[model samples]
Target chain A: MTQVSTTISKEKCFEQLLLGKTVKRVPGQYLSGSEGWLEAVRAEALENARALNFPSDRHDDWRFTDLSPLFQHGFQPVSSFAKLTPGDIEKFLIPGSTRLVFVDGCYDAGLSELGFSGSAGAHGVTVSSLVERIGDVQVETYFARQASFKQDAFAALNTRFFEDGAFVHVTGEAAAPIHILHVATRREAPSAIYPRCLVVMEPDSRATVVEDYAGLEDGVNFSDAVTEVVLKDDAQLQHVRVQRDEKNAFHIGHCSVAVGRGSVYAATSLAFGARVSRHDLHAVQMGEGAEIRLNGLALITGRQIADTHTRIDHAFPRGKSVQLHKCIADGAAHAIFNGKVIVHPGAAGTDSSQSSRNLLLSGKARIDTQPQLEIFNDDVKCKHGATVGQIDADSLFFLRSRGFSEERARNLLSHAFAAEIIIKIPVPSLVESLSRTILDRMSGVRT
Target chain B: MINKDSRVLLEVRNLRAEVVVDGVRGVEILKGVDLTVRAGEVHAIMGVNGSGKSTFSKVLAGHPEYTVTGGTATFEGRDLLALAAEERARAGLFLAFQYPVEIPGVSNSALLRLAYNTLQNERGLEELDPLEFEDLVLEKIKVVEMDASFLDRSVNEGFSGGEKKRNEILQMAVLEPRLAILDETDSGLDIDALRIVANGVNSLLTADNAVVMVTHYQRLLNYIVPDYVHVMDGGRIVRTGGKELALELEARGYDWVRAAA
Candidate 1:
């Protein structure tokens, strides 16, 4: 293996990169005199990002995933927005949805359909660009509050440089699901884009949102995104995130959610593309009687790599959490999953369970799964399990004896392994589309 | 019942086989066994445990774990040992497993439909689509006394012992094989399940097909009466007789047969 070591440390390299990339603009008015606060937050985040070192193999969380392939390229920021027509993005659109489309980190108002207005104190819902809603107090209070950029380098970079992204605020029942689509157009040089989103759901409101990331062409690009979600008391939200970038792209995503009292939050994330990708998710129950369900699936082939790290924190009494994560790796691809559930002291009657299941299709395919649980109170109920294995021989033979060819049987079993998670996506259209994608991708899994 | 003019379906002569462990052959299990069966007939092979009754059925189905050292077994005048397990199934041979494996993701209806369609396509017959196949499988599922929900669930993933055995019979009904080998299909079944499975097998029998059941007890025979009973001991059949022989063995036990052999 070729070594990518350099005399200049990764921290210094990124510090110089950040120094040259930081930009300050005359910001829009938000809640009267909010411009100074935004700049201050940006500056402090940039400084914090510069002070921290890029994760190396020595880091406990970064031991299995080597970022040398991503760090080797010095990706430049996308200088110009690539022009795209309505037909160009027609395939990613979901029926009965209000859309917010962003091309290369820049919001395209012409391509977006906002069913609700951005006026202050909107009653029902508001789905618009983040930069346009700077006047809302909810945006100011919850924008960078939930997901801390102080320790995470990628989140800090996204906070410092993101120009515009989707902003969804729900005060009542939403009539249609909101779809936030981010597309990366191929460029001649290696480019980088930062995508940001903030969602605030008030008490007694309900809604569903989908965060979709896609690429137009197969080339090297970097997408660092951060999303903060706050579910207030008695609120319900279903979030589905799909990442299907190009084969050579690099993606890093961070999503932090705060669950309030009597609220329910459910998220399903699917990862299917990118040469190297990583996602970090954190959900904390801030009040009593909160519930959260997290489901994830990662399917990769060839030389791709996917890593997921998730933490669910139960801070109060009577919180419930259930999580399931699965990975299917074929060829020489690698997959990693680390799930942690922490029940703090005084959080009695907390019910939590987690399971991680992995499948390797080839002799060289690899998977590393870790399920961790920490219960400080004896009154809590928590359980976790991890399993890694290949196909069952007896099952294979049974199928063959029923006249199914070996290839067809293998494909059927693998597809069934992934359909368990894919079937849980709330949207019927997205579920069908993703099922087709998985079927097409799994056909190449056979040796 | 066997007709004198019925065509021969399976013929075995001086067959010898053994289990393979890590590519090495173990002790011989089926030592020079011989048997013959014709269409429209049901035969029962009775023996004590480890007498190679189950091994004989698996070896006939071309299970990879067991290797045939020397054998001459023909199915419908074709060398059965020369075909792959799947090819044998396509040529109309079915083995109801003793311990049916649970497939977690593949649905029962899906597997049955695929198996049925594959056989149909191989025979140059019309294949059914999903809707048509569902209709056909729903009809076949009733033969085993299984409800429609069994079609939607994973293939015997969480099924009970009896449910798994019935699932095997369900597959047999859908494939409609010409020669069916029931290997201890009644081992784990209750009294009701045994009758249901036996009745299912009885209903599927026709003038062109035959059933070979391997069981230790004669209780299953009360429902699906066998036309012939063969006593196997020490890896070979020592005696062959009519249905009364089964009742005699149940009364006298295997000690008499061993002493006579």
Candidate 2:
């Protein structure tokens, strides 16, 4: 066997490619965060990014998803936007409560509304950005606490190079949902955008935060995003992440969450676009009785590739976690799903399950799924499953035998398969839109 | 074909059809089958297994697997073979399966309404809203003696054999197709379920519609009597007789029928 070292020269490294761009920080936006926290993390992340190579297929975490195509191009900084319009942002805007709109990796003040408060203003919440908040000890802990970028390159790049990030903190009281839109405008040069988000749900508070990602279909673009979520004791947070970028774009995202004692955190991601996209999600059950649910749906077509990797760490006793991720690959599209759940010692009575199901519409389309369970203590119930197959011929014929056309039968069945995860999303209004997006993005079969 | 003088609802003339072999060349299943059904009549076709009893029924309904090599099938003077499966259904022809496929996450009520609404639109009739459709479905469930909860559950998913057969009968009741074909719907049903399914078919029968049943047993005919019985051998109807032919064949067996043909 040949021993190969995972190393890269300075010219090919992501840090060298993305480091020289000047980033402007808009002050006074983050009401409760610290800028020094970001600066402190950036220094370490830059050092790590410079010394490490971008993750290749040689890496176990990225074995199925290839990043060579992303490495070929030298992405410039996002210094200019060819087109940024209100209609572009408004067309995809889901009408609801409070929202923050970011266009081309910068906060769009005109399109944003920061009215996250109770009716009488007594239970008013702070929805700000990291560029505005002053440095403090608690802010530093939430910012740099959970997501360890020791072996992660994109995450380290996110820490060092984000233009700005979203901040939504619940002040121990409940309020309406906070919807954030991260829209990408077509840039003059082939470039990359790092948009980060932070959600800190205070103890005993309950809220929903929806992060929607979209882009114009002009040309190729690259997006690397990192989202950090902190849940205190007995807090409940429903996080919905949507990806609807250009077909020529490449997107990589990392979501890190920490669940406290008796806390509940549920997240659902609807990934529909991107030339090649991979989302890595991780959640740690830090305290006892913590519950976490992770659900995802990916529909890739043509030569597009979509992948999702998730890991749940059940550290304390009485923790329960469930993960269900599904993808439909058509044309020559490829999808990868890898899920792992670790039940450590003292995590007794832990119930954890992970399931990944894939559907191939055409003969050439393919999927690779892996579900791993690492358990150390007894007295726990844990299960993991992965399935990859075409649609059931019997089911198709059964529907076609009825009044349904062959195309309609495939659509209905495919929709039903993905609906298993979509319906689990707590947000009611998202159901119809997500359904339409999945049908729209599905390949091989025309609806 | 039998009964040329009657007002024919469906007429099949020298129907020769085959299914694709390995998605390419033809493997013939129906070899020149000729049958005719008149309005206000229920015709039962009985044959042994591998005799292509199910294929003939499927070909008439425009199943994509079966290709017509040589045939002229007319439903109400329209060329039935040229239409799609959904178009044939919209034109008031229904085929109840021997084994209904379970479609998970799609409720029985939703499927029924979709089929009903498509047919209604084809007929230029007013479509029923969800509430109105629910009321109609609840009323029709009694025809099959089915529980009201079945309407809300996923179509045929986790249903017993008897329940699936009853669900098909209930669909027949709601759709009210001009020609209803039951392809061995009684194959797996018990005596009580067979009676209920037959009763449901009987209730939907009218002077303007017709029924075609493909079965291997004479027991189904006991509940809802047939107007005529045809014995199929080698994909063609070799003998045509009244309802007694079914009982005679059931008692004597297919060997005698084959010998007689």
Tens-digit lDDT string for candidate 1 (B1-51)? 879689999999999999998789898999999999999999999999999
Highest lDDT: give the candidate number: 1
lDDT agreement of model 2 with the native: 0.81
DockQ for every prediction shown: 0.52, 0.43
* Cα deviation of B128, candidate 1, in Å: 1.9
Q: Per-residue lDDT for B112 in model 1?
A: 83
Clashing residue pairs for model 2: A28-A132, A29-A132, A30-A132
lDDT comparing candidate 1 with the true structure: 0.86
What 10-residue stretch in candidate 2 chain B is worst by lDDT?
B1-10
Chain A (candidate 1) TM-score to true chain A? 0.93
The lDDT for every candidate, in the order shown, is 0.86, 0.81
| Best model per TM-score | 1
